[model samples]
Every structure is written in C-alpha cells, then in structure tokens.
Target: MRSRLLFYWISSLLVSGCTRSGSPPALSFSGGLVVAQIVTDSLQLVDPTRQRRIPLVRYFPQPGRGSAHKLKVALLNHAYHGKNTDYKFLADNLVAHGYYVISIQHELPGDEPIAMTENLYQARYPNWERGVQTIRFVLQELAQRQPQLDWQHVLLMGHSNGGDMVMLLAQEHPELRQVQQLISFDNRRVPFPRRPYPRVLSLRSIDQFADAGVLPTPAEQTQFGIELVQLPTTIHNDMWDGATEAQKQQMNAAVSHFIEKK
Candidate 1:
C-alpha cells in the first residue's frame, strides 16, 4: 500500500509537472547519534482480522551513549494528499536540533476531498480521526522500543489538513499534555484549541485559495497564550519544502524562537 501510494504520488507529480523543491542537507551531530533513514514501517492497529498495516515515515534520533539529554519526538503530518517531502525542510531542521521527527501521509484513495468552506469541510472529520489513530499507533510503537522516551517535550506540527489533524489530536486526547507545543502551517478548517496547555503556535500565509483560519483574536491570544505569525506576501504552499531561501530562513527563525521560549 505504501509503495502504491508513493508510485501514485510520483506519477501524479510527473503528469502535473509539479516540480518539487530540493531537500535540506542531512544534519551533522558531533558526539551524537543521528540516524537519518527513510523506511516503510507499519503495524496492524485498526483491524487484526486482516494484515492491514498503517505506514509511516520514521526519523529516529538517539543521543550518543551516556548522553544526559533526553530524546524528543515531533510528528509532522502533510496536507491532504500532499507529498510528504513537503515537510522535509522542517523535519530536517528539527532533527538537526536533536528531535526525532516523523512525517505522516494521511490520505487514501476514495477519501473525501478537504475544503476550506464549513459546509464542504465537516465531511472529512473521519479522515482527521484516522490520522489521530495513526499517530497513536506510532507513539505506541515508539514507547515499546524506547521506554524512556521523553513525552513532556513532544512537538506536534502539520500543514493544511495535517495541521487540522494536529489540532484535533491536541483537543481530543488529554494524554497528549506532554505535547509541549502545537505548530500549524495555514490550516483553514479547524479552530485552535481553547485550552492554555500545550502551547499553540500558528504560522499563516497569504493563501489565495482558502482562508488561513490561524489567527486568534487579540483577546483569545491573551487568554489562551496563542502565538501567531503571519508571513508577509507568502504563498501557503511556500511554507513547506517548496519555500525559497528567505522563506525557509524565516520559518526556521519562527520555529526556533517558539521552541526556545520559556
């Protein structure tokens, strides 16, 4: 299924003449073990009757032996049917900063297309729920492999539909309090969580097709402590891998600042 998805995406890109941006260079970690490998990893979670596996791209980073720093995980979800490589720049940046990043692809064939309008958008709630299940499965797998993994500092991030999924997970699952921050890139449909926990940081682009739906009212920002950054004259798609050097740098700066905030 994973191979088929990749093939379908590649073929679609070719036929559409959609040129992909270059991936970031692998991060170098001295005196640290940075294992950067892409593998088709899966587990049967939804149905045990059949061997249905949920595929995920895992980026595992382990500190050098005897290192005191605890490992942190970041799960990044791509937009609806969007290429996972769209998140490559952010993922590489996270890994370079010593985070274990996993970029998830959540679209399957025959699923309802996501839309910015509320009437056309409510139909895709189930898809977002399924994405939540996938994240749970991955987290379960990680726990089994590394029992001591730090959940307190986990980061959840996504773009478009993926950003919606991040919002859903943070709201529905109280166990995710360990998720230190939730960062979204131009997610249009879902409203930000109203809680004050698991700090919310959203980045908005000047989307021509759909509303950004990222900004909180000044009152809401003050009350919930939401952090919003609206990029100047930036396209929504440029927030991901297709970003220019300046855009990428801006994204990095925003994210770095968010992470470093006390």
Candidate 2:
C-alpha cells in the first residue's frame, strides 16, 4: 500500500511538472530577505489504512541575490505541543545561510496536548510510518523542482520525538540515499532499530533529557553512530524561549556551526 501511494505521488508530480514550470513565487520574511513556501498537493499517507493531502511548508532563500549553494533540509517537530514555532528561529538562521528548510506538521487529530500525547505510539498511530514515507517522497519532489539543489547534501533535523522518527526513517529507507546528515535536539533515548547513515549529530541540553537519565544506552548510541554534543547551560526550552538577545545568538551560533560545518 505504501509503495502504491508513493508511485502515484511520483507519477502525478512528473506528469504535472511541479518543479520545472517556473520559479515559485518568493515570500517575504521578517527580515529584508525573501522566502518561498512551496505547497505540494501530492500524496499523504495518513495511516496504514488511509491517505490524505500532503502539506509541506518550506523556507527558501531569495534567488540571484547570493551564492548558489543548495542544501535541502527537513525539520520535524517534537512531541505533544510541538509545532514549527519551536524551529522558526533555527529555520530562519538556516535560510540566511542559503539552505532551503522544509518542515512537516505531524497528523495529530487535534491541537490539544492530551490528544497529541495519545497519538505518539507507533503501534497505536500507524500514520507514523506514513509520515516517514512522506518525508522521503517530499525530498524527491523538491529535488525535481529545484535543479540547482545538490540532492546529495540533504539533511534531516528533528526535535524530541521527531528526532527519534527521523533516526528510524533513515535506518529504514536506505534506498532513498539522499539524506546524508541527521540532527536531533533534546530527544529522549530510544534504541535505534538499525545503523543510521555516517553523519549523525545529536544535541541535548546538559540537565534536560540527559539528566532525566532515560536516554539510549551507551551500546545503542555506539551502534547508531551518533556524534552526541551536549550544551551545558542551555535548557531544553532555551531554543524556543524568549531568551536574551545575546543568549539566543549564542544558541544559534552553536546550532549553525553544527549544520554548516563540512
């Protein structure tokens, strides 16, 4: 069923020329720069038994104003109460650095906290697999649309549960072969089902998830090939909170270095 849905999506995009038609119109960001949010009405596998419209939000840097270095990044949100707001600062920073950031809002029924928590389980929520499939499908769709994009440099960035999802997806869809990097922020430790690709960066706050003492085991960490980086003073919410200007800058700098480093 997953394979059939993916085939239909690719076929539709190819028939419609979703990427080659023309440059998508640019959107204005808070700063002077322009960003583009390309929405694709392609396939969305909602659950094991159902499919829905796939919604993707993207932030593309202004074209022709800067050097053409393309990096396709997918940012996934964390658990209950998770939304793009958590990654906007980081996404904006990545846009300034000349990378296109695409994030998917998970298919939780209602925005309420309790409803989201109930849907977190893989067994209970079969849509989790579909979400993973959607990410892979979107990567291909974006590559077809943006010719200048270096498809080889795709990166996956997620927070908390989203981070765990990306890890598991990367392990499962090795055939996609486009995702070269993985970044996780403040995620609880869960055993990785299989080895992730070579480049994996896991960043956690010092006393946050780590101090909680329920992260992946040392053996599991080794097996997953994670290059774990800990931020000593930064809290789990520091990335999203209204920290001081200087504090935000410090946090942004650390994250930027990790993403932009060769």
Candidate 3:
C-alpha cells in the first residue's frame, strides 16, 4: 500500500515538473521582395543603376508593448550561393534587442561567378554593385513599410564576401554616409573604409588553411579608429551558422555593446 502511494506521489511530482518546463520564445518576422519583378516595367532599363532581381529578408522583433527605440539593420550574406539563413542567430538576437534586420540575398540562381582580371576592383565590382542596389531597394520599401523605425540608427553587417560588399557599399554610396555602424565577419577582399567615417567592428576568425585575407592590422585599426575582435580557434563558416551557442552569445554581446555605444 505504501509503495503504491509513493509511486503515485512521485508520478504527480514528475508531471508537475514537466508542465513547468519553459515554452519556446516567440519567433521573429521574416519576409522580403524581389525588386526587379515588383517594380514597374517602365522603371527597368530607364533606371541608370539597375540590378537583377534579388530577395531581402526582414527579421523583425515580435510584436509587443515596449518603449525600446528600434533601429534598422542590413545583413548581407557571403558570396557564391550563400543564403540569408547563414546569419540566423545574429539576426534573431538583434531582433530580440529591438532592431529590425534586413538580410539581403544578393546571389540569384544561374548567376555567373565574379570575374577576375588585371584590376582587382574591376574583378569584384559587379558583384558588389548588385548588393548595394538590392539594399537601396529594401531601404526604399522600409521607408514606407516601417515609418516608425529610426533611420538614424542604421547598422550594416555582413559575413565573408558579404563583409567585403559592406565595405564597398560604405566606399561608393554617399547616401549611406549617414549609416552609423559597420560590422564584418571574416571578410578579406576589401579593406575598411577611410578613417573618421562610420565606426567599424570586425570579428575575425583564424584558420591557417583558408587565407581569408587581411583584416585591418592593429596599427590600421588604431589609425582608422576601427575595432577588431579576433576568435582564435574559430573557422570561417563557423563565424555564422556553425558557431556554438557560447560563441554566438559572445558575438551577440559584443554587437549589442557596439550598437548601444554612443
């Protein structure tokens, strides 16, 4: 009789504990547009700066009652078939912290590789230009879709080739000059922008075999006023999706601090 009573008591306790296990947090909003198809046909060739149709993914904070100031963030993925899901953790955390993240899917199916030639810039110019135009289209859409967002708090972040693209955008787009913060994850092709412009935070990963290119040297960082954070045992791809939870959280904290910094 006592054994039967004890078993029932334990089972009840187990059920009670199971019921208290936390439910998953709500997911953020994700959506985008294909610029070329969405825009009017008259705006096609007539527009001097044109690009192939591209998709943009917006990961917005879950709807709630709060007073946190919202910022718009643009996250560009790496080159050659890279998808925006690569930066899922980064985007989700940013959303949780009151920022709207726009992930640009710059590469389309059947697109040719970025050409190589005598001029280094010429080799990658087309690819980078396409990314910039995609971002511009999304920004125009956001102006209408999210008027309450604080445009002054814009942040641009990218990984690998996407990181190179962000640097190129900073260099070529005068309209983006007002963009306040830039973050790159293991991009090697382009150097950081000129000194005293938008502040920069570069997260570098070390993998001897990859030859991921030169990040700003410490002296360069000091001269250009950029911040460089190195991950000693990290690999290139792991900097994005493959990163461990601890690694992701470390990056999230660093990014949050930089964004919140005055």
Clashes of each: 0, 3, 0
Write model 1 residue lDDT over 158-178, tens digit each, in one string.
888888888888878967767
Top candidate by TM-score = 1
* lDDT comparing candidate 1 with the true structure: 0.65
Candidate 1 vs candidate 2: the lDDT winner is 1
RMSD of each: 9.8, 12.0, 13.9
Give the least accurate 10-residue stretch of model 1, judged by summed lDDT. 1-10
User: Weakest 10 consecutive residues, lDDT, candidate 3?
Assistant: 1-10
Ranking by lDDT: 1, 3, 2
Per-residue lDDT value at 126 in model 2 = 42
Off by over 4 Å in 1: 1-52, 60-66, 110-112, 115-118, 208-214
Query: What lDDT, from 0 to 1, does candidate 2 have?
Result: 0.54
Candidate 3 lDDT, tens digit per residue, 1-262? 0000000111110000001134343333222211111110111111234646655656653344334455555454654557765766776566655566777777777877876557656687788777776666666666666688877667888887788778877877756765778888777777677666788887766562212234555566678778776655467778776777667766665666566666
Better of 1 and 3 by lDDT: 1
Q: In candidate 1, which residue pairs clash?
A: none
Model 2 stretches with alpha carbons more than 4 Å out? 1-50, 74-79, 108-127, 192-196, 210-225, 241-247
* TM-scores, all models, native as reference: 0.75, 0.64, 0.73
TM-score ranking from best candidate downward: 1, 3, 2
What are the per-residue Cα lDDT tens digits for candidate 2 across 77-105?
54435654455556666665556677676
**Candidate 3 — what's its lDDT?**
0.60
